[model samples]
Target: MAPTSTAEPRPSTTAYRQARDTLVALTGQHDRAVAEFRWPEVGERFSWAIDWFDQIARGNATTALWIVEEDGSELKLSFDELATRSDQVAVWLSGLGVAKGDRVLLMLGNQVELWETMLGVFKLGAVIMPTTAALGPADLRDRVERGGARVVVANAADSAKFDEVPGDYLRVCVGEADGWHAYADAYAEQPHPFETVTASTDPLLLYFTSGTTSKPKLVEHTQVSYPVGHLSTMYWIGARPGDVHLAISSPGWAKHAWSCFFAPWIAEATIFVYNYTRFDAGRLLDQIRRAGVTTFCAPPTVWRMLIQADLSGGKGDLRELLAAGEPLNPEVITQVQHAWDLTIRDGYGQTETTLQIGNIAGEPLKPGSMGRPMPGVPVALLDPLTGELADEGEIVLDLSRHPVNLMTGYLGDEERQAEAMAGGYYHTGDVAQRDSDGYITYIGRTDDVFKASDYKVSPFELESVLIEHPAVAEAAVVPAPDPTRLAVPKAYIALAPGWEPDAETAKAILAHARGHLAPYLRVRRIEFFELPKTISGKIRRVELRDREQRAFDGGQSLSQEFRDDQFPDLKA
Candidate 1:
């Protein structure tokens, strides 16, 4: 028997597929792809779930999603099965008063129910607010208040976090919980017809930025912005049909939607997940080998941890490797290339947009460079002071081209939006430099770049060098108050296993930095400390900077902080 869609195929679906296949055909031809690729002109009405996912899922028996748990329990859903299942879920949610354009706060782990609910919400035309379960009651309250959430779907175990959250929103839980509707009840009924009617510019997703520097901003995405914009991301990953793609990301953030949801599905590839309570590199490798994963994307932190583990066994069935979330250090790339016989391609993007730049597969890569602008992404580096194009400055997207991948704007914050989209460009707070060959190398964030004795300093440049040392596992560099130089680079080091955080380790790390870095970029002082991070695992350098400022103002010296003068050998 042939499976059928709940609704008929729309023209928008064919347009999107044609655009996607065009880019796929030019997979290895980076130059031609960039020059010829154009954004699909999706007309007014477009619903990716009903138009694209459903049309492809009809009568398709291929596995679309694969999830493996730590306890060895697994779940696999075929394309046809997922389409029918999501249709039933949409009907059930509609029965529960979930209406079009209503805001639904979805907080779930990397489970099958999460995917089902997301697709169902998309079909129902409801705006999804992806909140991390790690959020506490305080943060939840703020989201509810500011986001104007009308419904909330959460795990039963996390329901307590919302007990203090005052909202009139309907509560639905995956497991049994008092005062909450059972999510399992959605499966009790057969599928029903649910039409998806939404404009291409209709709001589909609302993501809160990980508040690394300040309060989290509400980023709004249209129906096509993510579902269609991720074509570039799919191209960067080189995902092909039937390929099992695994991306290490949580459900709450945009990266999750970037890899686990849109990009893989857009390519008609299997979205594979290996959920573990704790990160175990060996077990992850086992799953990758067992499932025969072809494409993989992970953050720089995970890559660093994986290198520490045994990689004597070669990479299994892996064709593409990628790292993002931050600029990857060159040494880590070298180590992985030596062991796995594969180079981890580096890419760059932000929560507000899809992949803007990346090392395309099958193209020659420049070491430490994040490749040229992605096809259809209007990338340009503009001078921060002059607001004109520069070889090295803040990275901005040319708004004149009407890039479809960018978010509509910051929701309800016109002043910030005006500033962000000022000068006919979208300012990405980070800065970068482009070589004559057009390969872009990431500098530090605009706020993170400082100066010492009138010479500019980039924290990432120093931290990259510090991590190359044997004793240093992770390092965060900030400006320390100095008497003569006004300010100097001070490093907070986290020692690796079998290394002690003593004076000897600090001196070794300092000397290594001096030898590798230029004189102006030398590490002046070091302290053994744990780095602070946001919930998303990004280093909270703002806190570190504040700590340094306070310590300098108090005229106090840390007992463990080592200065270059303390080690006469470093004085050279």
Candidate 2:
């Protein structure tokens, strides 16, 4: 279907369309795409939800969204239906005094209303602060106070969390609830066409990033930063028109918007979602098969769990598979390829930017590498000391070109923003090594890397090797204090099913790590415990490091910890 000729706002629709078409044409050609792709120079009055989405949505009958519940209930909406429904929602919200640039705290799950509210908020030019439903009253209070939210939209079950949260913000509920505006009332309103009240540079999203070491930082993204910048992500995921893209991510994180919203919509693809209360790999795979998912993107955690389940049941219509949010272990990738004959590609990006690096489809597979710099993303490995380009160093974005994908800055924190955008480069705070082929292999976070016996040790590398053990399910490597060496590599592991935290299991895991890693990178200590993580499911290595430091300082010992030095018979 072709887009209708609607009078576009300030940005000439021609420029945006041409740039988008160029990317679509260069889907499989990685090198050319990287060289020729450019961020479109949008005019000052551009609005993506108004100019782009509504344009493509006119007269389009293709399925735009498909959501399946745990109980087998489903909700499907076509492009035209969503466009019209979002228009009504925008009108209803406008009537409730929502104006352009007003901050709205949106906290909801994977329901149809969430998507509708997002689009409506976008259409109204309101800044959306996407919050996870998992947060408690304390977190909500922090968000409302710091974000200056004028309105809050959440599910009925979560509405009571705001009882003690002092705010004058409008309380809008998804389901029926007292003292809250019902969201379903918008559906009964007459359909109204959306008009633009935003510029291309206006703030569209205020994301509270899940901080690993400190308090969560508020990352701000402009109108063009995410919606238009996700072309790189769309290309990386190989989201072609009519393809059903399924990305398993929570509602609050940037990854959700990366795949579930912008990337899929940019490709004119169907956003497929399966909502489950628990982690059931079998049921997820069954839903994928039933939905005929073609392009799939999931975090490494989900991919790891999926591999543990039966993959012998044949690959569903899944053509492209991707893993992000964290570094994917080579063992997990190898196991999936062996079962389905399809490689699980890896990609790298952050909440502060769109897809910076990714393994594009049809590209040569490099084990343990997160492929090359994404098209139009000026990526460089800068030496932390000299700020010179290096083969292995901190991953930085060359701001000389000022990539459109990057966030505006850390909101209300000018000092941190200046630090992050210093030296004419946007420091990612992560480290990597770029090989001759330009494939960037992840090292570890800058703070997570530690020195042991005068040798630099990357926790991710050790954790990757440790997870290869049969008894290990998930593992985190942190520095454990030592009498001789400053620190030694210690692994905190979560055992797989049927594996006990006994001496026998610990001995086998230690032996496996000894066989796999180099002498200097050997696991000197092992502990059986549940790994701590943020709400977004990322392992909190800083917490482990702190615990180890306190234990060493107080001359205290942790329970269930085994030391390689304790078993002198085992050779490193």
The per-model lDDT (C-alpha) reads 0.91, 0.90
**Model 1 alpha-carbon drift over 4 Å, by segment:** 1-9
Candidate 1, run of 10 with poorest lDDT:
1-10
Candidate 2 stretches with Cα past 4 Å from truth are 1-12
**Candidate 2 residue-wise lDDT, 1-572, digit = tens:** 33343444345466777777788788778899988988888778767887788877767878899999999899999888888999988889989999899999999999998888899999999999999999999998999998999999999999999998998998899997899999999999998777778998999999999988789999999999998889889988988877899999999989999999999998888999999989999988888898999999999988888988999887899999999999999999999999999889899999999999989888897889999998889999999988799999999998998889999999888888998999899999999999999999999999999999999999999989999988989999999999998999999999999999988788888989999899999998999999999999999999999999999999999877998877767754
* lDDT winner: 1
> What TM-score would each prediction reach against the true structure?
0.98, 0.98
How does model 2 score by TM-score? 0.98
Over the stretch 1-572, how does candidate 1's per-residue lDDT look in tens digits? Answer: 22334445577877887888888899889999989998987788888888888888877888899999999999999888888888888888899999889999999999988888998999999999999999999999999988999999999999999899998999999999999999999998689645668888899999999988999999999998899899999999999887899999998999999999999999899999999999999999989999999999999999989989888877999999999998898889989999988989999999999999999989889988999999999999999998889999999999999888999999889998999999999999999999998999998899899999889999999999988887878889999877888899999988888998888888888889998999999999999999999889898899989999998899988888998889886643
